[model samples]
Target: MSWLLDESHLADLSRGATLLGTGGGGDPYIGRLLVAEAIKEHGPITVLDPDEVDDDLFVIPTAMMGAPTVMVEKIPRGTEPVLALRTLEAHLGRTAQATMPIECGGLNSMIPLLVAARAGLPIIDADGMGRAFPELQMETFSVYGVHASPMVVAGDRHETVIVDTGDDDVRMERLSRACAIQFGGAALIAEYAMTGADVKRVAIPRTLSLGIGAGRAIREAREEHRDPFAALAEFFAGTIYQNVRPLFRGKVSDVERRTVGGFTRGGCTVAGFDGGELELRFQNEHLLALRDGEPVCVVPDLICVLDDTSAEPITTESLRYGQRVVVLGISTPPIMRTPEALAVFGPAAFGLEQPFVPVEELVSERFSEPVAV
Candidate 1:
């Protein structure tokens, strides 16, 4: 029932988290680095299986809810989550047994670790989403009817709000975004206070292992001189997509960023691949992937734009002209295929009349045969 993720697993976990981010999860680097540093400093984070959680144990999932672009530049003062969690715990008149990660992609994934490390608590090994999302209400938490409000959203100096008005998740999302915008486009937040038994029932168990496994598959595949793409394809029933189009690789050519109705909206262009090309459009998280006007991938699915050689994630905010990069597409989860789920993230959601092409089918028709890997 006891487990620990070593420092060595960060990269794999990060990669997996990035994949799960499904184009909306912000870049995982900052989160990964923060968690890595904390692990290195305080020793690895102790993990527990969902079953290990007690029915009576109070659990609060922690994460970052703001523009990914602002995270790197602002450099968290590091006290937001620490303060937010403390405020929540204090209000509840009880201590938390373990901290949970609301979303496991990018910075959100790492925030819980930091909170747990700073507050000296055990971190539950599972989370609401296997990846990341743009809104707080879009998660396994919503499906489970776990209310995510009265939650504390904090700023660098510990300025915070304890919100709980029985608002729906989406309303909570809007409120958090407004708070982040007021705080200048980035809000470190935490929520979903539930007992360990509820967490055990609703949270996906050992999902972290999935990230580590997929990441290891990629590394081992490349090391063995096999097709890393194919290896990943097998890991997720996706096929290898070799049509890596040319995208500008350099400092961000130009960035247009703004917060609209609480959503962080903006896109950037890179100018190196061929006299300046390749652009990414994002809303707090990457939303669409285009290479010279051709759709490589889109949201409701996972599209990870990573360094060509190192496999590092380049944040939409941090991306610029002249930076070398390669974009990779992993299929989206089956959940997104359901008519109901698609209603929220399908092409129509982005104003595209295109129908939802399950990543499995997309990979099969666009890449290789549809075999696992």
Candidate 2:
């Protein structure tokens, strides 16, 4: 069931889905220009593939939770996930045969192709974090216990909220981050109501064909200039953060935000590659990757920052002051090595004191470098 997929493979599936959006899948170039302007005004969008859905169908995953700097200053009015999946299919009386993707990184994988081309529905290509994580029960759907509040949410005007709660997924992420801070931060949910065989048993399979083969091998290694990170390490096998530290890339001299308990925490400080001074901390993503005080990196892994050179994904609330970032790290999210994702984003859940270390064995055995592109 392939309704559509051709705008040059959604620009190589938004460049390998923005490298698994490990930098906190937020900046996918305005969600790949809103999935190429909703596939050039809703033209192509069939793409179903989780074995064509049907094992009793009724899938449902959608996304865009909140704060990639308020999703580029609140842009999505695009009928909020088809009005939160048709108001959760009229409160679940049946009618959801397809439409998936909860994560594949950055702009939550072109927001299910602009919410399945403006909610005409039929975008089942699998997701649920084949990459990209900041929260929302960090993929693998609450590590199998799955259940994110009877779920349904559709804002940007149409207004809807479902959330059949029982105080699960932490009271459904505190009532979906307080309705994404009252829809000023972002919302559009449409969550976990699986079926298609439990959405292929907690997704992550064929994640949109691995975001179209990591967005067609980094757009054919940048049109043959070659070396799009060695063609994404020939489609990464995993565990490869070989000692990466770029606490400084000259600019962003500073940045800091705070939202507290509800979580928004932030920090930034770039200067210049190794002259001195460097600091990075974030909560909406990028946990810790210091240098002037030690601890090269920490968190459940991943510390990304990019955009230092069109690498993209920069959002510590739209970091500023020059803006040339680099920070990187990859390795984490196997359910963050369990123990309940290391008790919520390991290293003492960001209060850090030293414990977890798996940014690909802390970058191939403590920062090694030399594999540059």
State which candidate has the highest lDDT: 1
* Candidate 2 wrong stretches, greater than 4 Å: 1-11, 18-84, 89-102, 105-111, 114-116, 120-136, 139-163, 170-189, 192-217, 220-222, 230-342, 345-355, 358-361, 364-373
TM-score of 1: 0.79
lDDT string, candidate 2, 1-373, tens digits: 5546756677667766665664456666776777777878877788777765677877778888876666666778666877787787778777776777788777788777787877667778777656666667666665665676677767788778788775377677777778777877777787776788876666655566676675676566667776444445445543222233333345678888775544567777777655665687777676677756555667755565666545544556667788766666655435436676567546674576777765555444322344321
Put down candidate 1 lDDT per residue, 1-373, tens digits, no spaces: 8777767888787776765564445666777777777777778777878887788988888878776656656677777888888888887787888898887676676788787777778888787765666777766666566788768888887798888758487787777778887887787887888888888766766656666766787778767877655466566653222222222334456777775665557886655444535567777666666556656566656666666555555555555555666555555545444565566556676666546664434443322542221
The TM-score, computed over Cα atoms with residue i paired to residue i, of candidate 2 is 0.33
Question: Candidates' lDDT values, in order?
Answer: 0.67, 0.66
Q: What lDDT would candidate 1 get against the real structure?
A: 0.67
Worst 10 residues of 2 by lDDT: 239-248
Runs of candidate 1 with Cα error greater than 4 angstroms are: 22-24, 221-225, 237-264, 267-281, 289-298, 321-326, 335-340, 343-353, 365-373
